[model samples]
Target: MLGNQKVVQAFAHEADAQEKFEDINEDLRVWSLKATFFSSITNPATRFVNSLVYASVGIAGAFAAVKGLLSVGQLSSFLSYANQYTKPFNEISGVITELQNALASAARVFELIDEEPEVPEKPDAAVLSNAKGEVSLEHVYFSYNPETALIEDMNLKVRQGQRVAIVGPTGCGKSTVINLLMRFYDVDSGSIQVDGTDVRHMTRQSLRTSYGMVLQETWLKSGTIRENIAYGRPDAAEEEIILAAKEAHAHGFIRRMPEGYDTIISEDGGNLSQGQKQLLCIARVMLCLPPMLILDEATSSIDTRTEIKIQKAFGKMMEGRTSFIVAHRLSTIKEADVILVMRDGHIIEQGTHDSLISQNGFYAQLYNSQFAV
Candidate 1:
């Protein structure tokens, strides 16, 4: 609500939002009513039963006393015993509702625990070390659903220290390429290799650590600026963190904050602007200086001026490091060592920007469409 309040109000969705809120409120109201009704009945029923028992004991005891069949002290002791026995039922009734809620929550938790993992690590997986950043996908086939074909017979090779840019329309497998390279999803019928070794044979941790990533959407946890910058390398020294922040052009803003690098950010960086969050994420990846990099529209959120600055910083960062850049903005990737244009999950055009544009094919058409007056 806080993040999107302006948007909601601008679109005149106040009524819709209120209606949804009331719907949730009504459901909760019904739930509370049911709980309250059950609780009220159980507690009062226990009390009523206890009271009736006490009344019966009193009346019978009085009759007995009148008939000289019971002592006053014995009658009082019997009444006290009956009260003690029924008191536990009242306590138990009070907690029955809470117990039911807890049991239902536990059942949901156990169901989540029992579900299978989508990507499981192997026990005997080899550790990828000192990678030269060579990557290749061989005759790859993958689909989210078994019956649907997303990517098929895909083949590509990326050499060490090369910058490969992927450009395509939405749902054309741009991000999926990054997922395959990162081993987030294994190819259905082929192999992805890094440094001549199949990725599946490498330990997931070691393979993932070899690459630094920055995405269009930024994610920052609740922490100080310094902590967020050092997320990828928690043990990074103060100097190292500051240097990376400087490289990413985030150090100036950090120092300007009320507490400098110590300024506490709210959850998901609610306290900071989108560009600031993106800069911090970029700083994190810069600090790691991984052998390979994956940048998925890394500068999309920044203004043009800031984007230019970040692109310069990214150019420096990508030096001698294999980088896979997935971007919708064609102009940002002109300097890429190789460009792969995808459509329908296939690499339809592959060349340098100038070479592909000269061919005057799909890549040329897309590029021209963007720059068309």
Candidate 2:
């Protein structure tokens, strides 16, 4: 049952599912034949046991009659009683195999119920409300394992409607300062506050709703284009959906399709290019227009020329919204209000682009290396 969801998410496609189905179907057929073979043999086996019991009683009766201890009519009646007893015994013996299979299935269900969840929700948790887009993280620390730390003693403050871009080399813990901001994972130490309320104090659902995210790993359900775009804002009108698509530079491509916004998208966007899928994700977030935004730029698949146009669409989306951007292409983040340069899970340098360039620090060196040909 869980495997079906993985197939729908495109970890495997329809062809793979078909192959698995045929394999399981063959196994089922063989198993059914085995059961039928056992069932067909069961009645004969019971009759053989019944005949043996009758023969043993008859031999004793013959001995008694020959010794003048019993009559022929009495011996026949004894044999008839033995046959009546075997009939009920034979009926019960037939269902033993089926009953064992049912008990084994029940045992599996009990095993699953005994397992515990990793993170249980807290009772009496409050709901986050009236988020004004201000986010602050102080003295944060986190680690996936005890031997290695991913984030340590991190502190940040962002006022409302600000754009902060994080840039770093590989393995620098650039796993979305944005993810932390949205409370995807809780920090081991320190507090993450949005609009002066700590995230842990509120329900995760309500807190996440206040933010809109567009990451490189874009996700959309298998449905019409319009449905994918309006996922976060399900009640959005057609005009609003089109406006959002236009703002994200997705409207043009969507219109040229055979059915426009009504066109169906295959799972994991098998029918669209990576760039096109990313644009649809952006459109989805735009429709919700959350007060906070997280944008992770995965530009490796995007051509330099194509990215220039996409960045323009991003600029308009970021306007007047508190956003955190993670980018490898330094050019896309040159205009950020603050650029944080991270190294090995630590923030090494931070400032505006020009200011960092003036310092000739880590940010400057990294930016120069990108253009070194």
Candidate 3:
């Protein structure tokens, strides 16, 4: 919960972390005190109940002896026999109470076990093998909620090694198409095929491993530059790692660091600037060189000069690989073999950059809006 304070602070939420922390601390205190109180009483409570049982039996035996219905020696023997039974009864009660607490903890474990997965794998699914990177989405449909439909009847196709750009305003289902293609969420009514096989039929590892992705929001682990770049292919050679970083224009900055590529990044690359982190991410993907690529506004964080260099690296990376580019920056994908314009959960326009500009449609409006005086 203390970790949550960072997020609250980061977003400048009105909620008071200290106030919440005090309340939670009070709850913890109460819980701990209650547990300690229960534990402290267990043995004493058992002894108190044992004494009551013994006293009642002893009193009854003494009265019987006085009436000449029982001998003094017999009373002693009866009290001894009673202790054997009552002692176990007291111990068993304490054990039962302790087990109840343990069972409560076990129930939490079972809750995790009982949770249903969002995507269940098919029985006897085949591993996707020898992919040529021909991707197609045939009549796909999806919605996060029934009332707020996102993508409806979306169809797309990309021949092997082609670079296709998806352009649209936010919430126009461009990322949804990528999600469906990756099987992050299955389409409601249609199929996403990779290399002539439906994504559902292949192992998620197989399908995802075939694609190399670099997103606008870069994610990096706490590791050295070399380790982060070789994350995808951990066995990648040192020379190959350097080559990838050089290609992505990352090597120069990395070399200037105190330990060069050996410098360890702090959590989420906090030690680095946003553009530097993005360059590392691009280098990481470049090292892997998967047959298919997804660049989702991948250069948005970089300055114009860095973006130009990274774009050149991307040009090399996309060669002979089927690539999908999702960009709000029209210039980044101006040379794409196909440009798809999305609006209101549908593909409204499709063509080359020049062809789409010539048509003077939604794509033209979006492109022109970026440059409007």
Candidate 4:
């Protein structure tokens, strides 16, 4: 009885094991079937020919050994040898083909890794502290390409918290000034100073942390609306996020979103209108609460109604912070404390809106061409 009971227990265990094996085999079969279908579609001719040759060669060799008048030992040895040779040949062919593909992929990946970074940080760069937004450009010369100069010997200075507007024709390099200030590209000559310290002597990260930038192209990642707003300062509280959004005039539309703050935004915020995307970008910059702000055509893409809302938000954001506005819209910068009119990398005119119009120079011509209507 004891022996019988032990046997029964062992049989039960075996039955359970078989059931588990069958489930796993089913899963493997499903996976293999999908893989085979994909492989057939991708490499139909080669795979089919390889299979056909392997099968035919294996069968023909076996048939010859079995039917031909050969001694048992000789037949066994021949079959074993053929099997060994064919197995390795098949494996080697597959490995060689895969190795070629892997090498090609590795080459492309390594090329990217080998690329020299455009901006190199200094080994002993100083960290910036107590930045009061005083900025100066001393004999600054910059060129995007070696053959073309953008700004040359440009001298400008701004007191702390002063609003400066840069206006110019399409290629006059109005935006280039902001890029230089942010150290996006090093100047070919001269120097840019922030709060009396040369910007180049400060760590890039530390220098940029002092300013917030809003560009024409608003970049929004795919995430919850709150997540997008809180991106600049991740640890920002829920109330703080809401306040920043409200300040940017984004709270109204955000509240109307299907899930409000929890609403998941699409990449580039494609689901939202262009104006709404800009509002969110403004909100993101506002959340950073930097001491200085750069607005590059911030209102260019928005409708008049949305522009009004954004202008109000801009007014709030500009308070107590040094602001730089780069725009082709003359009306947008009319209220700027000082407007610098640039032409072919040269500042042709600099003054308040009324003063520039009185001078009737490049800026006056631009203003009249647009706003004089």
Model number with the top lDDT: 1
- Mind giving the per-residue lDDT tens digits that candidate 4 earns over 166-210? 998888897889899999989889999998888898899889989
lDDT of 1 by residue, 99-159 (tens): 8889999999999999987666677888998789999999999988898899999999999
Model 4: number of backbone collisions: 0
Model 3 segments more than 4 A misplaced: 1-15, 118-124, 145-147
lDDT of 2 by residue, 25-90 (tens): 999999999988897788779988999999999999999999999999999998998999898878
List candidate 2 stretches off by more than 4 Å: 1-51, 61-93, 118-120, 145-148, 298-300
Candidate 3, residue 332: Cα displacement in angstroms equals 0.7
Which residue pairs does candidate 4 place in steric collision? none
For residue 289, model 3's alpha carbon misses the true position, in angstroms, by 1.0
Runs in model 1 deviating more than 4 A are 1-4, 39-103
Per-model clash counts, in order, read: 0, 0, 0, 0
TM agreement with the true structure for every prediction: 0.80, 0.78, 0.91, 0.72
Clashing pairs in 2: none
Candidate 1 clashing pairs, residues 3+ apart or interchain = none
What is the C-alpha local distance difference test score of candidate 1?
0.91
Displacement of the residue 309 alpha carbon in candidate 3, Å: 1.6
Task: Please say which candidate is ahead in TM-score: 1 or 4.
Answer: 1
The lDDT, on a scale of 0 to 1, for candidate 2 is 0.84
Off by over 4 Å in 4: 1-110
* Per-model lDDT: 0.91, 0.84, 0.89, 0.84
